[model samples]
Target: MKFKALTLGILIASAGASQAATVNEVFNGKMLGTNQRYFESIAGVPRDSFRNDHTFVVQNCQITATIGDGKVTALRLDLGQGCEANLQSFIGEDAPKPGQTITPGVFGSGQRYTASCLAECGNAADPSAYALWQAPRSAGGMEVLMEMVLAGDKAMTAADEWEKQIKQAAGMDYVLATKFNCETRFNSIAEAVFKDVPVNAITVGYGLPTQRCN
Candidate 1:
């Protein structure tokens, strides 16, 4: 009987070790999640109606979730191909500098803006840029806020400005396309989408990071 109990204990310990190892491997960059959502952009004739320009596919974009929380929190996407120049134009000259990362949050001085840059800007049609958002912890099933494509590098800079903006921009379509409980105002954006969701006991930055952007 003692032998059987010992064996059972070992088995349980092994199982836990396996789960921890898997999560560690993913977080530490050994493995990557396979699921990714793709968004495409459309093209039209140049404002020059007389120009014989052919309409071509703009870009192929994909958003891959980095964590295993069952919802997409952070994502990575490829900006449009060979359009580094165009991308720079969209995001603008003030790109994120050394020690600067464009995350979600409110800027300083009570500015009326929420910045959500993520890697992608939020242009569903254009894959050049993308966004990542985390819904307010209170919103159940809304844990992973929204992810979207950006036009270019400029959005990257703006993303560093604030958190609310990140959520608002990344989840813009979600707010528009879906029936989420929310309140939108000129200086602020809030919603009840996360109200029903249980607030996580763990503060976001308190624990070790579970995901990393490539």
Candidate 2:
């Protein structure tokens, strides 16, 4: 009986320790202002380093931290295949879904903006790729951005096809209308196509705009 009780206590302690190492717990709180050396002590030596950005693998999740002025400014986590379990752990139950109006303060950030195409809307010169949601200039000057992938090689093929159809039906008189119309149409299609797909990557920036949210 005594031996069994001792073993049970040890098992419980081990489980607690394992839970403490989760992605969220390891990366959350007071991380924005920390330095590279301090981050490496917890995240281990980076597998790749480029300028101020360092990529490290923590619990199979690829986390890249951007350091500026010797302090960490941003973190981008690529939750690829086999890292699905960590998704919920990192973002919690408020993970943004397709076509859903993301609640502000979801990631402890302020206002959120959704970009229909991968790039700026109404920009015909830019290629439409994926969908992105950005929450810039949040509390403590932090920014949060999320990305979702679209299907197919070109990804913009559907958007292009729709644009051509609109132009054919509306003629040159409606050339200006095609821009906003196609943008909205492409957003709907992207939402449907990636409804069941999870966010590919999430980036959190501190004190600056990582990707043009404003």
Candidate 3:
């Protein structure tokens, strides 16, 4: 039950109510990794000033688990600016140049990285999400594909286990209240929580054009 095509097929195939249920599972169950130090440091930094640390500066990350056919097919770990920068190094670029931005995303910091463990979630032909996140082909870079295959019974528990690790390593709370869904799941979570579709459209999930580590 991998998510070979990241499209709306599941939403159309499954009943609205069922798709909604799956969305709720993904929303409420998804855990957010915290960034205690980042928030703490944010308070200290001046409102207009910026800090430069060629490493992951943020203190939190998030996970979204989409269930299909009675199993978790996709588990996307949305990295914070800091996390994204940290991982930039692994793909290729590890440091920031004279005028380039490195306080956020770059390869070497290892701050942000997406690990797609399952083969059924993104492109079945390509089982790893790492490829999708990798540098573009034109840049002579690899693509980071979505990999979410490690969510079986025992492995599924890893999501919960990560909460404890987050607390211990980062000394922060991991209670999450927000989730991003395309439509089926998005509408479902909104209906379950607010009893309707989300309006006012405040962007709270991933894929922003800009970000910061600290």
Model 2 worst lDDT window (10 residues)? 102-111
Tens-place lDDT digits, model 3, residues 121-144:
344442211112334454334333
lDDT of 3: 0.27
TM-score ranking, high to low? 2, 3, 1
Off by over 4 Å in 2: 1-21, 82-141, 152-197, 207-214
**Which candidate would rank higher by lDDT, 1 or 2?**
2
Q: What lDDT, from 0 to 1, does candidate 1 have?
A: 0.27
Model 3, position 162, has a per-residue lDDT of: 36
- TM-score, cand. 2 vs. native: 0.50
Judged by lDDT relative to the true structure, which candidate is superior, 2 or 3?
A: 2
lDDT scores of the candidates, listed in order: 0.27, 0.52, 0.27
**Candidate 2 structure quality by residue, lDDT tens digits, 1-214:** 9999999986776555444444564455456678876766666667899998888776878888888888888777775554432223223344444334332223332233233433224445443233334332333333455554434433355444444554565554444333433334334443443333345566665443422322
Cα-based TM-score, every candidate: 0.18, 0.50, 0.21
lDDT per residue for candidate 1 within 46-141, as digits (tens), equals: 122212111122232222223343322332222223211111111223222322323223111121122232334455544211112333344221
Which lDDT value does model 3 have at 12?
51
Identify the superior model by TM-score, candidate 2 or candidate 3.
2
- Number of the top-ranking candidate, with TM-score as the measure: 2
Q: Relative to the unseen true structure, what is the C-alpha lDDT of residue 209 in candidate 3, on a scale of 0 to 100?
A: 21
